[model samples]
Target: MTGQVALVTGGARGIGRAISERLVKRGMKVGVGYSSDPTSAENLQSEYGSDRITIHQGNIGARGDCERVFDEVINAHGRVDVLVNNAGITADKMLTKMEVDDWDRVVQVNLSGTFYMAHLAYLHMAERGSGRIVNISSVIGEQGNAGQVNYAATKSGLFGMTMSMAQEGSRKGVTVNCVAPGYIETDMVAAVPEKAIEKIVSGIPMKRLGRPDEVARVVEFLADPESEYITGQVYSVNGGLHM
Candidate 1:
C-alpha cells in the first residue's frame, strides 16, 4: 500500500481522521479531503509529510468541488486506489419541526455528495480494474432515530447505492462497501443532551460509545487489496448495539 493513493473525504477530524491515519500508517499516500477548516488536514500532511499526504480543499456536496478534488488527487498521486466517502452532516429536527432547507441540506451533503464522489472515483477505478470504496453510514439508517429522519434517509440510501455499485464494480475488480457506526465518541455525539446521551448509552449492550479507531480499522480492512471478495456488505461498528 506504500505507493497507493487513498482519498478520504472529511478526513480532518473524528472517524475520518482515524481512517486517514490508519491508511497512512500502512504507507498509502493519502489525499485528505476537507470541506472547510484545513487545520486538521494540514496537521495530517505535516505529520505524514507532504510526499505521503496531501490536503484537497473542497466540498463533497458540490459537483464542481467533487470533480476538482478527484482531478487534483489524480494529478498529485497519479492514481486513486481507494475512496472513503466519510463526509457527512446533520441538521437534526423532528419531521414536524424540520424545515425544507434542513432536509435538503442533509440530503445534498450526505446522499448526493456520496453519489457524486463515488461516480467520479468509479470512473477511474473501473478503468484501472482495481479500487476500494467505503461508505460510512450510521446505525440510525437501519434503526430510525426520532429526530434524524433526514439523516437516516441519506444513510440508508447509501446502503442501496453501495450494493448496486458493488455489483457494477465486481467485474472490474473494484469493491464497494458500507460501514454503519452506532453511538461513536465523536464531536457529533458530544453535542447530545446529557440525559439523551445517558439513555443512549444505557440501551447499548456495550455500555459505552465506540471509538473512532475501531470503526477505522474496519474501513482499513475493507480498503485493503486482499478484501476484494468482500463487497456490498455493511459492517456495523456499533459495539453490538443492534445485533
Candidate 2:
C-alpha cells in the first residue's frame, strides 16, 4: 500500500483516528477529513508529517462540503486509491420522542454524506479501473437499537448501497465493503452510561469492548491490493456479539 492515497472521513478522532494512523503507518498517504477539532487533526499532521497526511475540514452532510473536501484531497495527493466513509453522528431518542430535525440530521450525515463521498470516489475509481471503498457501519444497525431508529436505519441502508455499488464496480476493479463495529472504546461508546456499557459487554462472547485498532485492522485488510476478490460483504468486528 506504499505510496497509495486514501481519504478517511472523520479521521481526526476515535475510531477514525485509529484508522488514519494505521493507514499512515502502512505507508499510505492519507487525507484526514474532520468536521471539527483542528487540534486532533493538527496533532496527526505533526505526528505523521505533511508528506504522509493532509487534513480537511468540512461537513460531510452537505454535498458542497463533501465536494470541496474530495477535490482538495485529490489536488493534494493526485488521486485517491481508497476511501473510508467513517463519518457519522448520532441523535439518540425514542422513536416517538425523536424530533424530525434530529432524524433528518442523522440521515443527512450518515446516509447522504456517505453517498456523496462514495459516489465521487466510485466514479473516479471506476474510471481509473481500480480502487477500494470501505463503509463504517454499527452493530446497532444490524440489531436495531431502541432509541436509535434513525441511526439504525441509516447504517443499515449502507448494506444495500455497498452491495449494489460492489456489483457496479466489479468489472472496473473496484471493491466496496462494509464494517459493522460493536461497542468499541471510542468517545461515542464512552458516552454510554457505565451500567449500560456493562450490560453491553456482558452480552459479548469476548466479554470485553473492542478496540479501534482491531476494527482498523479489518479495514486495512479490505483495502489491501490483495483483497480484490472480496466485495459486497459485511465483516462484523463485534467479538461474536451478533454471530
Candidate 3:
C-alpha cells in the first residue's frame, strides 16, 4: 500500500474526505480532486502533507481534469491501484418544474463526472492488471427519489456501467464495483430541511442517517486485497432503505 495510490474525486468534504483520509492512513498515496473548493483542498493537503496527499483542483466532469489528476498520481506515487469515483452534485427538483441548468449540471457531474474518472482509471488500471475501482452511487439510484429525477437517473446508469466494467476488468485482473450509500450524515444531508429528513427517515428502518466513516469503511473494504474476488456488485450502505 505504501507504493500504491488511490485517486478520489470530490475529496474535499463528505464521503470523499473520509475515503481520502482512510487511504492515506493505509500508507497509500492519495490524489484528491475537488471542484471549486481550494480551501478544502488546501486543508486536506495540509493535514495529509503535500508529499503524501496531492490535491488537484478541477471539475470531475471534464476529461482533462481526469487526465490531469491521474497524471499527477503517477508522477507522485508511480502507480494508481485504486480509484474512488465519488465526486457528484445534486439538483433536486420535480421533473415538471426543474430548471434546465439544474438538470444539465446534475447529469454533468453525477454521471459524466463518474465516466471521466473511470475512463482514466480504466486506461491505467487495465494496463497494470491489478487495480480497483469503487464508484459512489446513491440508494436513491436503486430506489428512485421523487424530487431527484436527474440525479437518480445518472446514479442508476452508473450501476449498469459498473456491472459491464466489472466483466471487462475481471479479465485483466482489475475489479469494478459500485457503492450506493443511503442518507449519510454529511453537510449536504445536514442542510436537508428537518421535515424533509423526517420524511426520508420514515422510509428507512434504521430511522437514522449514516455516518461518513461508515461509508469510508466500505470503500476501504472494496479497496483492500481481500475483496479481490468481489466485483460486478453493488454494495448498499443505505441502512435497509432500498432492501
> How high is each candidate's TM-score?
0.98, 0.99, 0.96
lDDT of 2 by residue, 104-158 (tens): 9999999999999999999999999999999999998899999999999999999
| Per-residue lDDT of model 3, residues 42-155, tens digit only | 999999899889988887777787778778778887888999999998888888989999989989888888888888888788987789999999998998989899989999
lDDT of 2 at 149: 97
Clashing pairs in 3: none
Model 2, which residues run further than 4 Å from truth?
A: none
Stretch of 10 with least lDDT, candidate 3: 60-69
Q: RMSD to the native, candidate 3?
A: 1.2
Highest-scoring model, lDDT? 2
Better model by lDDT: candidate 1 vs candidate 2: 2
lDDT of candidate 2 at residue 21, scale 0 to 100: 92
In order, the Cα lDDT scores of the candidates are 0.94, 0.97, 0.89
Clashes of each: 0, 0, 0
Instruction: Answer with 2 or 3, whichever has the higher TM-score.
Output: 2
For residues 96-189, could you state the per-residue lDDT of candidate 1 as single tens digits?
9999999999999999999999998899999989999999999999998998999999999999999999999999988999999999999999
Using TM-score as the measure, which candidate wins?
A: 2
lDDT of 2 at 235: 92
Better of 1 and 3 by TM-score: 1
The per-prediction CA RMSD against the true structure, in angstroms, equals: 0.7, 0.5, 1.2
